[model samples]
Target: MKKKTLLEELRSGTAPPFIRELAGEENMDPADLVDAMLRGEVVVPYNLCRKISRPCAIGAGTRVKVNANIGTSSDYTGIEEELAKLRAAVEAGADTVMDLSTGGPLDRVREAIVAKSPLPVGSVPIYQAAVRAQEEKGSIVDMTAEDMFRAIEDHCASGVDFITVHCGVTTRVLEALKNNPRVADIVSRGGAFLAGWIIHNGEENPLYENFDRLLEIARRYEVTLSLGDGLRPGCIEDASDAAQVAELVELGRLVKRCREAGVQCMVEGPGHVPLHEVEANVR
Candidate 1:
């Protein structure tokens, strides 16, 4: 018999330590949390390989969670500085951290951050793939689907608890974006990377097309997939536009797939929304 996965355990009516910890932290019942997990209402992103010291739950009925992103950029490739930011974010009560390193030794930076981080660590593997493509092939458009998936698997193998995948940035969504142009266009770097690849190669987004393969890796490592919004509004002026809505609709499909696969998943929303539109956006 195969080993039961985290999701399988939850579905079997067993509450794991992570769930118990998160439920206790949130002052909720463990059985109720297990029910939420089974219903795909709660996600506890804990890699079995990585021992988490600060486990926080994200989803319905839980207190709002905070995820702080700290990583090295091309302009500032300082791992120590990023580490300092990580420390500060944790001290200031960040529930999780995402290493969006796009510069310097990408793997080294991620390993260092993940090794030191007590909170769950997440990453955008496409960023590493895009950076590798630029360094080796001279452009983000040169990043192959194999490179993207390889980076994702490597990140999971290295104990990343979660990952942000721009699975909704499809050819159809690009058509929607074209028909209803936004002032900001595309603001997500990973989204833009995949978009460039699709347009240049005339292919479907690999993350969207080969989602089952992605799920296999996520299931093996128990990595939660944060379905990214590639066409999310970069500015208030572009809030609630057709492109953004289209991507959200695509993400909804991905979320359903995730539940069917028994892999934890969450939807990533827009970058900006006006005060008046926040309620609508949440709805």
Candidate 2:
């Protein structure tokens, strides 16, 4: 029999130990926190595979959390440097850290970071899939859906606390982008990868199509899914465009799926926003 997750505990009207601690940290009643979590208004992004000593909650009534992105690029693949950044980010009060490395022994780097990070660790597996495609198959477009799913599974098995998946970038969202063009078509890397793959393959986004497989992997490891904002506005002018809204609608549906699957999730938003638009974006 599978063990009940933190979410399952809440669903059963009980607060997990970590939730109790987090509620106390937030000065919120544990029952209130559990209720908010049940309503999909809050997320506790911790993985059962990796026992997080420094657990924290994100979403309603929690302090504004900070997640520092640290990783090696293809151009500058320094594992040590990335580690230094991870240390600095944690020291500087980053609530979490994401490993977005696209270069130099990616697996080794990820393992090192996960081993060292006291805070929750997140990743974008699509980056690894794309990079592997480029290295092995000679093109990013050559990567198969299997490749992508395999990468996601690998990350989960590696005890990645959470992952960003661009499951909202669907064929319909692509059409929306075509019908209502923006200054920047798609600014997110994972979004671009899926968009390009969909265009090349003449199919729906694999992440969207195979979301159940994703849910299965996440459920096994208790990995939180950070549904990537593939159609996120790149520029101030592109904010709140139809394509963006379309993807957001898709994400809303995915959120419901996550909740039903008893998998934790949070939505990632636009890369850039104007000062006035920040409030609207958050809303």
Candidate 3:
């Protein structure tokens, strides 16, 4: 039998002939299904480097994918333990892995897991930057912007496939945050550090002000950027407040710029959102 193109499936109101044949079945119209598939709104996020056994599309006309986050924190685990969690997550069908490790030997931990991961590995470069800064300089704000960029470069060199950069936390947002009243002010460690650094140094955030440089680095490594939501509401009461929405608006614009530069980007969502507000938060 001849294989049916997407166009052919659209004209009929049933499954494509190929799908029917694959199931050793018949009676399904190929045209309608083919039309649906050819709408061109679907996206499959499989990187050439990631050998996905059951790859799926992510955009319109596909099932929603959920990601599981697992990493070592300063107070609790070690690399070995984190790796065990990583293995378990993959076995449990996590689409990707984000290393939020803030303890022990950072680089060694990241490298070991990256080497072991078959799926795309992601990290918040800011976390490692702060961790190293506290170790060497005793305070995160004491670390220069150059140090942060260097940490980002190192992570890219170490084969991290994607990184979360909080480039939306601009000086303007910091200024607004200073005046905004919220219960969980500055819940994000990276956001708080950048805001304080800007206030203390009287300078703009390096990530926000120097985003082009960040894009260049990402382009060089072919690494995707998960634009971190620095000002994400920490609690339900604070959700969609001016400061949080301000950061999100900025991030949306930045996403366009990143796409234009051929650097793959996705927006990181909020944390601590109440179950009732989850849909609104995502929207």
Candidate 4:
């Protein structure tokens, strides 16, 4: 029999040990924490693959959390440098750390991060997928759907506690972008790869098309799904545009699917906006 996911167990009225500990850390009643989780107002991003010593909670009734990103880019792929940043994140009281390495020694870098990070770890696995496609297949647009899913699963098995997925960049959303152009069309790297792939292949986003497969992989590790809004505003002029709202609609649908699949998920949002639009964007 398959193991019950954290969400499924929560649905069965069980508060897992980690949740209890996190509640105490937040000085919140465990029952209240569990209640908030059930209400889809809180998340504890922990992967079963690794036991985190510095796990923390996010969302309603908990202190605001910050995640530090450390990784090696193609131009500067230094493992030691990344480790230094990891140390800094730990010392500076980061709630979590994400390894966004997009260079060689990818395996080693991620392994080192998971090995050393006491806090929960996250990643944007598609960066590796896009990198692999660019290196091996000659173009990021040439990467197969299988390649993306494989990257996601590899990261999950490697102990990534959570991951950002750009599944909301759909064909319809692309069309919306064409209809209403922006100063910055797509500023997110993962989003750009996916948008390019969709245009080149004339197909739907593989991530959105095969979300169930992604969910199964996430369920195995109990990885939290950070549903990324790929078409979020990249400038003040693009704020609340049709493309942005269209992508949000797609993401909202996926959140329901994640709930049905018993996967813990969070929604990412607005990128850049005018000062007066900040509250509106958040709302």
Candidate 5:
């Protein structure tokens, strides 16, 4: 039989020690934390494979988390510099760290960061997939769905506690962007990769179309899914537009599915809104 996910354990009254510890950190009762987890209001991102030295709980009734992104770019690629950034983030009291390295032996960089990070390590698996496609097939659009899923599995197996997946970048959302253009359209790297793949292939976003497969792999590692807003505005001018909201609407739908699967999930969106629009947007 397969092992139970943190969600299942919470339901069974057998949540892990780290999860219980998270409640104490939040100044919440263990039962209360369990209740929040059941209600999908709280998420403790703890992967079974990698024991997090500094575990964290994100969501309602908890402190706002700071997830610092540390990684190498195509121009600047090295493990030591990235590791120094990791140390800096931890020292600065970051709640989590995401390895967004798009350069220098992606696998090695990710694995090294995971081994060294005390905070829960997160990553954008699509980066490696897109990079691999560009190197091997000469274009990001050449990356197969199998290659994409494989990268996700590899990251989870490497003990990444969470991942940012741009599942909300759908063909419809892309269409919305076409109808309603932005001054700085699709600034997110992962988001742009998926968008390009969808338009070039004339197919649906694989992440959205094959979310179940992604969920299964996530369940196996018990990694939290950060459902990213692919069409999130890049500037104040593009803020809160129809294209952005359309992606959020799709993400809201996916959030329900994530909960139903007993997989911990977070919705990352609606950023870059105007100061005045923030109030209404949050409302």
Candidate 6:
């Protein structure tokens, strides 16, 4: 392939075909558009391995994308049911999918979905470790740091292109949580588990303590890390509390670290933030 350029497409009168087709009009030169796409200012997120009919960009100049989460829950659904939901989300125009399956044969379910999915697949490895602990041991708090890291490695080895790590939940933040009074504290399952474990074990979160190791795994697989907001408010009242801010600050530091280490990272923000605070939360 001579590698189609924006200029060539424009010269051929087929530049930005999708955009023009949608607008029912055309104006831009193909070569100029190709130049834009080549710059990091625009991105075509489609993995060459995943054949996408309607490709999209996800960077500086692209439209904001929405991700739909679909997965099996312990009480109600199974793999087959979740797979149906995955297809439904894609059909409904979801830009991405995250398998937040905390129940029902986690590995088997993840593998089946990833193998079948044409779009990128994401996951939270902590959920798998917690589930495994409950099944194999007695409690999530009993899960070893090694157990958690192993699960992360397993997910990467299985071809998960992205992962959410609640590395912001540090021992100091957990201590702050004990002192802070809020309406709904620690809403994230992974966060709650790590908080409980830290309180019980009287140690720092392994994810935070061993972030370099986590980065190593991610760098090896080129997996993007969605740094989870473990202390994200569960209710409007708890929004942007001390614990939350503390975690956010820690995540910012980690983000820089990941960037320095050549690993991709994005911070996950609040869960129950008020509508008014959304912009500030993003900023």
Identify the candidate with maximal TM-score.
4
Please state the error at residue 260 of candidate 1 in Å. Answer: 0.7
Single out the weakest 10-residue window by summed lDDT for candidate 3: 22-31
Cα RMSD for candidates in order: 1.5, 1.4, 7.6, 1.2, 1.4, 6.6
Best by lDDT: 4
lDDT of 1 by residue, 128-191 (tens): 9998999999998988889999999989999999999999999999999889988989998888
Which pairs of residues collide in candidate 4?
none
Query: What residue runs in model 1 are displaced by over 4 Å at the alpha carbon?
Result: 275-280
Error of 6 at 206 (Å): 0.4
lDDT of 6 by residue, 1-283 (tens): 4433332333355645554432222133434334444432333322222333444444443457778798888895588888898899888888778899988888888888777776677899999999898888999899999999999998887777678899999988877787897788778988998998888888899999999999878766657788899999988889888898888889889977875664556678867888988877765
What TM-score does candidate 6 get on C-alpha atoms?
0.81
**What shift in Å separates residue 205 of candidate 4 from its native position after superposition?**
0.2
Candidate 3 residue runs with Cα over 4 Å from true position? 1-60, 75-77, 272-283
Q: Which pairs of residues have clashing backbones in candidate 5?
A: none
**True-structure lDDT of candidate 4:** 0.90
The pairs that clash in candidate 6 are 6-30, 6-31, 6-34, 7-30, 7-31, 10-30
lDDT of each: 0.88, 0.89, 0.71, 0.90, 0.89, 0.74
Model 5 — which ten-residue stretch has the worst lDDT? 274-283
- Count the clashes in each prediction: 0, 0, 12, 0, 0, 6
In model 1, residue pairs whose N, Cα or C atoms come closer than 3 Å (at least 3 residues apart or on different chains), thus clashing, are none
Model 3, 90-137: lDDT tens digits are 899876777888887889888888878866778888888887888998
Worst 10 residues of 6 by lDDT: 40-49
* Model 1, residue 257: C-alpha shift (Å): 0.7
lDDT of 5 by residue, 32-88 (tens): 888988998878888888778899888888889898988999998999999999999
